[model samples]
Target: MAGKSGRTIANVPEKSLKKTLFCWEGMLVVLFILINVFCASISQSYQFENVLREMPKYLTEMFLLFPMAFILVLGEIDISVGATVCLSATMTCMASNKGLPFAAVILTALLVGTICGLVNGLILTNFQELPPMIVTLGTQIVFRGIAEIALGSGGSISLTNADGFRMIAGKVGIIPYVFFIVILMAVLFSVVLAKTTFGRSVYAIGSNRLAAYYSGIHVQTIRLIIYTVMGFMAGLAALFLTSVLYGANTTTGNGFEMDAIAMAVFGGISTSGGKGRLLGGIISGFTIICLRIGLGQINMNPQLILIILGILLILAVLLPNLSARLNVKKKA
Candidate 1:
C-alpha cells in the first residue's frame, strides 16, 4: 500500500507539470504562428529572404536573452547590460582603428564586458544585502559614462577596418551567420538549464535562497558566474552589433535591456523566478522580432512601436499574475 501510494502521488505532480508546460508552450506556439501570419499579411517585404536579412541585427538581443533568462531565473536582474554593450562596442572599434589584429580586437570587447560583469558580481555577492537592481543600475551608469568619455566630443567611433566585420556579417545562402549562432546558443543554454545539476541548483536558489544554501549549493558562486556570463554575452552582442553598424556610439544598445526583459516575460518566464523555460523565451524573442520588423516595414513611428511593445510587456506580466490568483481562488 505504501509503495502504491508513493507512486500515485509522484504521478500526480508529474502529470500536472506536463500539463502546465504544455499549456503555456502551446499557447506561445499558437501566438507565434498568429504573429507571423499577421506580419506576412500586412507586409509584402516580410517574406523569408528579407526577414532573414533583417534578423541578424535583432538576433543580437537573443544572445543577451539567454543569459538574461538565467539571471531572471536566479531571481535577480541586471540593467547594466546595455551599457556593457556600448562600452564593449566602443573598445572594439577603437582597437580595430588602432590596427590591432582582428582577434585582439575581438578579445578586447569580450574582456571589457567580462570585467564589467565581474565588478557587478563582486559587489553584489560580497555585500550580500545590496539589491541586484541597485548594484547593476549603478554599474550601468558607470559603464556608459566610461564609454562616453572614451568616445570624446563626437560621441561615436566608426570602424576604420570594416573588412572583418563585413565578413562576419555575411550571409550563408539567405541565412545570416548570426542566425545559426543564435540557434546553437539557444540549444546549449536550454540544455544546461533543463538537464544539468547547476541548472537545478539555480532553480533551488531562486525558489528559496536560504534553503538552497543549507542544502549545500554554492549560491554566491553561481551568482558570480552567471553575472560574468551575462557580461561576456553582452560583449558578444557588441561584436555582432558592430558588424551591423560598422561603428559604435553612446546610444548603441540604448534600449537593449528592456527589449531582453520584454522577450523573456512575453515568453512566460517569471520575473519572480523559479519558473519558466528558455524555450518559451526563444519563441517569444522571435515573435517580437517579427512583429517589430513588420511594424517597421509599415513605416510606423519608432516611439509608437516602443509604446506598443511596452503595452504588450505589461499585459504579459499582468496576465500571468492574474491567472495565478484566479486559479488560487477557484481552488479555495
Candidate 2:
C-alpha cells in the first residue's frame, strides 16, 4: 500500500495476518451483542428503561469487579470483600442514623472497608504462610458477624433520614447516576491494567510470585496496595447500594464477592490468574446483569437462574483448558 507521502511502499506486514484472528476480547464483543439480542427477544419488558431501572442493583457489584481483577491477576482471591461491604454498609447506616452529616457517613463506610482490607493485607504479607482463600474466609465470617451484632436482634436497619441517599439515587433522564460512575471507573481501571508498568507487574506476580519478587517487583507491596484498593471499592459499592435500598442489613452484600468472581471468570479472566483483560470483565458484568434482569421480568425461577450462572462459570473455566489440551494433542 502506498501513502500520499510514499517514498517507497512496503507490502503489508505478515504480522497483520495474525492480528486479524479473533482473540478472547473479540469473542466477548460478539457474545455481548448476542446476549443483548437474546434478552430483548425473551421479554417485552427488556426495554432500555426497564433495564436501566434494574441496573443499579447490579452496578454495585461492578465496582468490586475492577479491583477483583487486579487481585486475581496477582494470583490471589479475597472472599472477604462481600463481608466488607456488609460491615461498611452497616457502619454507614449507623452513622447516618446517629444524625451525623452525610459526608461523615460516607467516610465511615470507606474507612471501615479500607481497614478490613488493610487487615487482610497485613496478615497475608506478614504471615506469608496462610493461603489467601483461607485468610479471606476467616475475615469474611468476622466482618459479617460484626454486622449482625451491630444490627442486634432485628438483623436489619432502615434509614430514618433518606434525604441524602435519595439524592445519590437520583437519575438523569432515565439513566441512573451510578451508571456513569461505573463507566468512568471501568475506563480508568482498564487503562491502568493494559497500559501501565504496574499492571505488567501484576501479571508477572500471577505468573510466578517468586520470580516477580526476585525481579524486584515488590510483590508484597503490590499485594497490599491491591487489597487496600479492593476494600475502598467495596466501600464505594456499599455507598451506592445503600442509596438503592435506603438502608443496610446483615445480608446487605451477601454473595457479592462470588458475583464479581463469576463475572471476571465468565469474561475470560483466569481464576488461576495472570491472564485476562478488565475490559472483558466489565462487559461480562453488564451482560450478566442484563441477563438476570430479563429473566426476572419473565418470572423465571431464581434458583434456575443461579443454576444457569453456575453452568456458565464452569464452561468458562473448562472450555479454555479443554481447548488448550486439544491443541497440545494436535501438536504432539
Candidate 3:
C-alpha cells in the first residue's frame, strides 16, 4: 500500500518494527553530538553550566519550531509569525504596564495572537484564491505596523512589574523553565504529527491537496486550525522572549520566522512538504542554537553567521535534489 505522498507503507509488522541507525535522523544525532564536542574543544566556556544559562534565549525560538514543522508539512508558510510575535509581545508588555494581573497579561498576549491567526484563517478559507505567502506578507506588515503604533515615540515598552516575568524565567537546578516547556511541546507536537490520524491528513493534504479534499479530509478546516496553532505558538514564544528581555518593541521578533524555517529545513524537513519529520527539526533547532552560542562566544560577526546559515540552507535544498537526480540517472 501507498500513502498519499506516493511513499510505500510497510506491509509486514516485522518490517515496521525494524529499527535502523543508518537513517538521516541517526546521522543528525551523530552530528549533534559531534557539534557539541567541537564546541567544547574550541571554547572552554562551552561547558554545561554556562550553556544552560545561555540556552533560554535560544529556547524562545524553539517554541515556534514545532508548529512551523506542521506548517511546512502542509506545504505552506507563515512569514507573519514574527510580526505576530511582535504584536503579541507588544500587547503583553502593554498589559503588564497597565497593572493587569500576570494571568491576564498572558491571556492578552495569547488572545491577540489567536485573533491575528483567526484573521489569517478566515481570509484564506473564505477566499480560497489567495496564496499563503501573499496573505501572510500583508498581515506581517499590518501586525508590525500595529505594534509600531502602540509603541509610539520611543518604539519600545518595558515591564513595570518584572516579578511575574522573573518567575516564569526562573531556573530549576540550572535549567530554565522555558527549556522544559519546549521539550514537552516538542514531544506532544511530534507525536501528533507522527502517530495520529490528524497527522495523516496533514501529510495527505500537503502531498496532494485535491486528493485529500476529494477524500473528505476537510482541507480548509485543517489549514485554519494549523494556522491558528501557529499563531498560538508565536504568542507562547513572545511570552518567553518577554521574560528574558523584560521588554517588547516593534523590532522584538524581527526575522524569527526565518530562523524557525531554517531550523526546520536544516533538520531535514522539506519545505516542498509531504516529507521529513519533526524530530529532525527539534534536533536541528538545538544544533543551530548551540552553534550560534559558540560562535558568539568567539565574537564572530553577526552578519557572517547569517551568511553561513544562508549557505547552509541553500546546500540543504540543493544537495537533496542533486542526489535524487544522480540516483535517477544511474537507474536509467
Candidate 4:
C-alpha cells in the first residue's frame, strides 16, 4: 500500500508538469498575433519585406542570448548578465579606442566573454549555497561598479572614429554584419538544444534535478555549463551594444537581463525552469521588440510595458499549472 501511494503521489506532479508545458506551448499562438499587429502598425520602412531598409539588431538579442534562455529553461538565472555584458563591451571598446586593431578588439570581446561565463559556472557549481540569481545580481552591481571606476565618468567613445570597427558593424548589401552572424548562431544553437544528449540533460536538470542525478546525469557539472553558456552570450551581447554605442559606460546594459528574461518567460520558458524551445524564444524576443516599438509609437511609457510584461509572466506561470490540474481531474 505504501509503495502504491508513493507511485501515485509521484504521478501527480508529472501530470501537473505536462499540463503546465501545454500552456507554455500555447503562448506561441499569442506571440504570433502580436508580431503581425506590430509589423502592420509600423511604417513600411521597418516591415519584414523592406529588409534592405532596416538592419535587424534584435536578431542579435536572440542569437547570442538564446543559449541563456536555454539555461533559464533548465532553471537558472544569471542576473549578473547585465554586469558581464557591460564588462565585455567595455573591454572591447577600450581596446579599440586605445589604437588596437578592430579584429583584436572583437577577438578580445569573444574571449573575455567566454571566460566570464566560465567564472559564473564555476561559482554556481562550487558553492552550494550561492543562489545564482542573488549571486549574479550582486556581481552585476560589482562588475558595473568596476566599469564606472575604470571609465571614471560619463563619456561616450565613438567606434566610427575607428573605421574598421564601424564597417564591420555597418552592413553588407541587404544584410547587416551582425545579422549574418546571428543567423548562423540561430541555426547552430537550435540544433544543439534540440538534437543533442546535452539538451536532454538540460531538460532533466530543469525538470527534476534529483531524478536527473539518480538517472546518471551529472547535475552539478551540467548546471555549471548552462550558467557558463549564459555568461558567454552576455559577452556576445556586449560586443554589439558597446560597439554600436561607440561608447562604454557602467550602465551600458541596464535592465537588459530583465528584457531577456521577459522574452524567455513570454516565449514559454518557465521561471521555474525546464521545457522551453529556442524557436519559441526567438519569436518571443522579436515579439517583445515589436510590442515595445508599437507602444512607443502610440506614446506609451516603457515602464507600462514592463508592468504588462510582469503580469504576463505571472499568468504564464499560473495558467499552465491550473490546466494540468484540470487535465488530471478529467483523467481521474
Per-residue error for 233 in candidate 2, Å, reads 0.4
Candidate 2 residue runs with Cα over 4 Å from true position: 1-21
Model 2: lDDT equals 0.91
TM-scores, each model vs. reference: 0.94, 0.93, 0.93, 0.82
Q: Who is ahead in lDDT, 2 or 3?
A: 2
Q: Can you write out model 3's per-residue Cα lDDT over 1-332, one digit (the tens) per residue? A: 99999998888755232254656677677777988888888898998999889999889899889988988999988899999999999999999999999999999888998888888888888988898899999999999999999988448999989999999999999989999999999999999999999999999998999999999999999999999988988999999999999999888889999999998998888888788899989988898888888877788899998998898779878877998999999999
- Please give the lDDT score at residue 111 for candidate 4: 78
Top of the candidates by lDDT: 1
> Which residue segments of model 4 deviate by more than 4 Å?
1-30, 42-46, 49-57, 153-156, 328-332
Evaluation by lDDT, superior candidate among 2 and 4: 2
Evaluate model 3: give its TM-score: 0.93
TM for candidate 2 is 0.93
RMSD value for candidate 2? 3.3
Report the candidate with higher lDDT, 1 versus 3: 1
Ranking by lDDT: 1, 2, 3, 4
Deviating ranges (above 4 Å) for candidate 3: 1-19
Candidate 1 segments whose C-alpha is farther than 4 A from its true place: 1-22
